[model samples]
Target chain A: MTARIATITSGKGGVGKTTATANLGVALASAGFRVVCIDGDIGLRNLDVVMGLENRIVYDLVDIIEGRCKLRQALIKDKRLSDLYLIPAAQTRDKTAVSPQDMIRVVKDLKPDFDWVLIDSPAGIERGFRNAVAPADLVLIVTNPEVSAVRDADRIIGLVEAEEKGPPKLIVNRVKPEMVKRGDMLSTGDILDVLAIELIGVVPEDEIVTVATNQGSPAALDPRSRAGKAFREIARRMNGEDVPFESLESKDGFFGRISRMVRPGGA
Target chain B: MNSGLAVKGVGESLLIHVPAGPWDEVLASLLQTVVDGGEFFHGAKLGLQLEDRELGAADLGRLRDQLAERGVNLWAVLATAQGTRSAAADLGLALDMGRPSQRAMQPDEPIETELPGDAAVLVRRTLRSGHHVHFAGHVVVLGDVNPGAEIIAGGDVIVWGRLRGVVHAGAGGDQDSVVCALDLAPTQLRIAGQIAVSPERRGAAQPEMARLRDGQLVAEKWIDEHRR
Candidate 1:
């Protein structure tokens, strides 16, 4: 199977790129696709903890890229999904330890067997970000509803476009329905109007996501989590399934519309 | 086949030296070069030097249409062929590059002054956070200037789209310089020695210009009163 390399990047930190990458890998694998998630944040390794594979990583991405071990030996298989895998990053080395060409060669080796290769990009538009997107067939930019987050997402989108990786799809994470209903937060429409890209998923804010993350299990594996459900739909969309988006705004939809009309223009 | 296309920056526009050969092959390679180049050709005016290559009106029209689709304006056509020259005339294109003295040998060199007095730099894309656009001349942006970004210009600053970032216009201590944007909501505005923050927006977005009025920075609607 030819793997589609999708890099999840956010120009700002703490925007849930790792969570989305882990969840997408789980959801895609749950759907019977062979998925491998690579934590591109080398020094700040966390995908292993999010995927519950931290203890099993004997050889990290640096090891494999540095030719210390075979590609198969470094892949830590997920306990829940037989087909899902985790290629954790080195915790000690900085982003300089790996290069874009190294990522391309490593991804090339993993391409023959996997259906999907998801990369968790680090924050900032620097060497780490470049390493993640170098081998990507598609890019998924993750951003929150805040102005700061959306602004960084715009920067990341520009860089991705500059790299000629095609237009990256957006995943707006941590939307609070209540806040949106109360006219206190930026709506999906507002973000879309600014970014002007295709929306693949909109994950609502849920405390269970934090709980699930701390538990070392992706929420996408849980049947009851709302954010998990959003990620599952993202995975389905990645698999070429036409799943309708869940309504994140209040049912009235009137408050959101009025807020858009009266929102401050410049400042 | 790929040698048929030579794309380079000349002053503010791009000059393409179109080599003579099979039209189809050269056209394919030319299109490929622009597409693969990425983010460089957007909003750029193109001058094609088609030497000794005769072309019909329809063929010239097709070329113009293709370049236009990619946000490139075909401003001039330099051709020695008489038929190609007339076809270009029918299309309202300039035949000569006009003195050719303004042609910059190095792409990234500061633009030689062409305006009556002031020099300017044109940026065609959004400058996101962490982006710092520093220029010695006036600056013009066709896209948004998001927060956390900074634009330092030696002269006036103009943004066709939103301007929410910090801008230091007239950085060379010219207090007479001005800053204009479609949406003037900069986090902080600096003109020479003066500094001011944008007042909170009250209503819908409108073009606004900021300048030093009696030693104080004021932003007003870009109307007939504020004509450049």
Candidate 2:
């Protein structure tokens, strides 16, 4: 089966792009879709660490692109999922080691065997970002609800439009519903009005995300994690499933009650 | 009208001329130019230079009527033939445009009026962060101007969509310049030498126009200036 390449990017750093990529890869592979996660961050490679597969890396994406090894030799099969694979980035070489053409060639080589190829793009709109998106059939821009992150997302959206990969979907990460109910933070509607794009997912700030990353396992594997549930919904949506968005107010707490009282129409 | 129309901007208005051709073809060609001009020739006084061509009164009247339908005024006719001049006179059209200076030298006229000159640029895309749109003329954007973006115009700036960026409307020190947008909550607004930050927005946004009021930038809801 031909694979659909999707690139996850955040113009600002620390906005959960790599985390989203790893979780999506895990979720898709768990759903019987053969998935491969590519670390496009190059020198600052973290997908392997986040995916809990850093110890088995004998070859990287550079080695495959440079023809030092066969395509299958560089692919590291996940310890849990037999069909899932990880292609770690080279730590010694910078982003210049792989060009956009090289990314296309590598993706073409893997398209016949996989169902989805998820590329985790590095922060900033540079060569690394270009290499990640050049082979993408769909682009997902990750951003925070803060003003600064939204501005950078807007710039990246403009650049993506310039590349003729228009109308990228947005994933708003680290949303604190308490601050939003207090009228102190920007809401989902506010961010959407500024960026003017489709919303794919809204991941609430959960401490389990930190726990999952620290343990070198994605949160999507946990059944009780809120962020993991959100990632699962995002993966289902990517698979063309009609999944209803869960309300952030589902957590019944003192803060949720105060928020519902403050804004009666809030979801 | 087809796009085979030659439109040239003269001193104050447009000069649309036609070469030697058939009566139907020339009229069609001339009318096409006026129609294809779109907003660029809207309400513009046109001088149709029909070099030595002879035309009937009904033909000239039909052309004038079509131009009037598009909001274009056929004010002057330039021709050497007697028949064309007579047709133009029958429709109350000017035989000669005279000198452009005569219109400028008219007494009791508003000489300081802002003429539609080379002082406006229409941007049809959103201005994202790190996008600097600096122009010596007035700036018009049809999309959003997101935060961290900056618009510097020597004249006024108008945004058809949201304006949340930093905008300096009168960079050339013209206090009369203004900034208008569908949403007027900009991060920073400057006119001439004064600078003002937008107040925290509450409730809903409305179309607002910001201009210098007593040497300070003041944003007021726009509710049809003619009605005001």
Candidate 3:
């Protein structure tokens, strides 16, 4: 099967790029597609821990690229999902250890074997970001519903377009519905207006995501998690399924009542 | 021998004029010249002037990588070929020197009747954050200018869509130059030596024009005479 490579990148740190990569890998694998998630963060490798495959890693991305190990030796299969696998980044090596050409070469080898290859890009539009994006067929830009994050996202989008890898899709993560209802947070509409990109998924703020991360398990494995459902919907959309976006607005909350009174028409 | 190649310093960067020739020979000679220059070429930012020499993205990317390995940074590409310009732009290289030392037209200089019009550059796409446009003449953008983007012009500046970025018109001290946009809310606006920040927008946005008035910068509603 020819794999479709998608890179998950966020220009700012701590905005859920690794989380999105892990969860999407699980969601896609569980849907019966063979998937491999590569952590492109090199020195700050965390996709392994997030995917609960830290203990099973024998070799890493750098090992494979440097010809120290075979590609099969570096792929750590996920314990929860039969078809999910991960190529963790080298903890001791920096981003300079791997070049953009190395990433493209490695991805070319993996394309013929897997159905999907998800790369977890590092923050900033530097070497690591370029390494991740060089091999991507699609780019998923992750950002929070804040001014700084959106600003960085816009910069990343510009860089992606400059590379001619556009138009990358956007995923607004950790959105607080209540804050949006109170007019305190930037809505999806506001972000789309500025960035002017297609919206892929809107993962609302969920406490279960934090809990799952702490346990070294992705929230997508939990069927009851709201973020998990959102990720599944995103996976379906990726596969060309026409799933309607789930409403994040709470219909019965206090802020919702105030908003309803203020607008009269359903928001 | 560095024949058919000229290197000169422009601001902080080195401007290299590459003569038109076979691609491989031109590239080899270019690299050889850099090698011969030794320490002077190392760690220098280069702006290549390729006159009518077409290049694709792969060729440009390879050249950049090769230069990078030799401790040189390729920051800009000045080319007459449309293909080379687009390729360089796709790689995020500056299309122009950005703030040329000489103005396109000096205010006190006598105008020539042979000249058809004032020199200007027209941009047809949205200018996202981190994108910068600097021209010695008038500037016109057919799309929105997002925040963090910047435009500096020697004369009037006009944006058909929203203008939310930093902009400076009349950079050569032409106070008569004006900046107008459909939505004239800029992060910061400057005309000649004066500067102004947009105030909190009230109500819906409307077309506005800003210019220097009595040595102060002010913005007013822009109304078309025919429509009015």
Candidate 4:
């Protein structure tokens, strides 16, 4: 099956781009689809670590591009999933080491083997970001529910359109359901109003996500995780399945109700 | 007398270098030259290039105020003089052209053909954030101009959709040039020399026309009867 190259980018840093990439890759692969995740951040590599495939990496994206290793050799197989793989970025190299055309070529080579290739773009609208999106058939802009993150998402969406890699989809990550209910945080509607792009998924803020990430395991591996369920739904949607968005009220459950009753106006 | 002043179009704006001489007399002559030009050089972005003249903060600030009072925008101050450059930098005027000029010749005749003019190109898609449209003639966009996108045209511009980006019309030297749109609320609008921003719309949007009026940029509703 030909791979659909999807790049996840956020203009601002530490907004869960690498986390989303790892989770989405795992979620897609677990559904019996062949998936590969590429860490586009050159000098600062994190996708490999996030996916927990750091130690297995013998060759990397730069090696593949530089002809030092075969593309298959660069593909580090995940310990948990046979179909899931990662082409880690070299920590010593900078963004200029790999060009946009090199990325396009690498993705083209993987297109024949994998069903989906998710690229984790570096923060800022610079060379690394361009390289990440160069081969993307679809772009997913990740943003938090804050004003600055939303604004950066808007900017990234614009750049995506400029490069003709649009129209990009948006994933609003780290959304606190209680805050949204209290009207303290920007809701899905508020984000869609400003961005004007198609909404792909809204990953709610879950403590499990933090714990799972710390353990170098994506939240998607846990079936009981709320964020994991959201990611699975996103993967299905990406595969052309029409999955309805999870209702926020149902997400909170009884524990959420108790907290809301006690705090009343807590964010 | 403002006899020694030599003005020329550098990029999209006029450049007037303040030659090393008596400050008081040169300033007077420069102001007189601007006044003599009537509406020709009014509301222009003038870059004063000082090669070696030292200027203090108060001197630069006073000059900026004086230029602003006369409808001129002091956008840049090019100086080889350390003190002058520092003063200008403190005032936040650009020291150099960060990017090369994207300039071309203006169209002499209106292009009514379907092929469009050689200077400008018509865009039929929405200009989202980060999209930039640069043309040598008038730009006619049939879609929305979102924030962060920019349009630079050498002639008048017409948008059949919402305009919110930074647009500079009449990039050549036609002062009577205008910009029209279905909803003409730009982040910033430039016509020949004058620059202005769209006032916040009270309610619904209507077809509007923007032009220089009394040396100031103004926007008015476009009526079908006033096609002429």
Off by over 4 Å in 3: A250-267, B1-115, B224-228
What's the candidate order when arranged by decreasing TM-score? 2, 3, 1, 4
Find the 10 residues in a row with the least total lDDT in model 1 chain A: A258-267
Which should have the higher TM-score, number 2 or number 3? 2
Candidate lDDT (C-alpha), each: 0.87, 0.86, 0.88, 0.83
TM-score of every model versus the real structure: 0.70, 0.75, 0.74, 0.64
- The fraction of reference interface contacts (C-alpha pairs within 8 A across chains A and B) present in each candidate is 0.38, 0.69, 0.62, 0.44
Tens digits of lDDT, candidate 4, A120-142: 99999999999999999999999
Model 3: share of real contacts kept: 0.62
Q: What DockQ, between 0 and 1, does each candidate earn?
A: 0.28, 0.53, 0.54, 0.30
Candidate 3, lDDT over the whole model: 0.88
| Cα error, candidate 1, residue B228 (Å) | 14
Worst 10 residues of 2 chain A by lDDT: A258-267
* lDDT over C-alpha atoms for residue B212 of model 1: 93
Winner by lDDT: 3
Task: Give the winner by DockQ.
Answer: 3
Model 2 ranges off by over 4 Å: A250-267, B1-99, B103-119, B224-227
Compared with the true structure, what per-residue lDDT tens digits does model 3 show for residues A130-185?
99999998999999999889989989999999999969988899988889878899
Of the two candidates 3 and 4, the one with more favorable DockQ, higher being better, is 3
Model 1 residue B154 CA deviation in Å: 2.0
